[model samples]
Target: MDAESQRVLEYLTEVEEGAEDVLATKQQIVDLDTKRNQNREALNALKTEMSDSGHPELRGYNLSPLSTEEIKAMNSILKR
Candidate 1:
């Protein structure tokens, strides 16, 4: 191939690689968005459950402090 043709091919190759990178990044963004939505739904469900259960420690605006057992339970859940 001629010099100009070879240069063009190299430029095209670079463009293709850049496009692939962009696609991979887009996929990652989509996956993260899906995960974020699922986490939000789970959090909302937990909140609803807490409210419905009417546990004194988790009730109204004037909330009391958590007990030692509650703290341990929360810690265990967070570690997971």
Candidate 2:
């Protein structure tokens, strides 16, 4: 009702809005970072599976399932 009270209320509104914006930005950054880490882990797993050299007969069928040609191609990429 009073001018002083009105100014205080206006200032509080501005502060709350700014804080909400900062929190939203931080949440977005955290989400993006989590997604990036997950993708990096998935990529590393795929690379490991592709390059594992244990023969299927020796290691059983549960090992990396790449064929001889695929393994050769992966080796070429590593050499490069």
Clashes of each: 0, 0
Worst 10 residues of 2 by lDDT: 53-62
Q: Which pairs of residues clash in candidate 2, taking residues 3 or more apart in a chain or in different chains?
A: none
Model 1 global lDDT (CA atoms, 0 to 1): 0.95
TM-score of 2: 0.63
Per-model C-alpha RMSD: 14.3, 12.7
Where model 2 places Cα greater than 4 Å from the true spot, the runs are 53-80
lDDT per prediction? Answer: 0.95, 0.93
* Winning model by TM-score: 1
Candidate 2, 11: how far from true, in Å?
A: 0.6
Write candidate 1's Cα lDDT for 43-74 as tens digits: 99999997788877655688679999999999
Q: State residue 9's C-alpha deviation in candidate 1, in Å.
A: 0.3
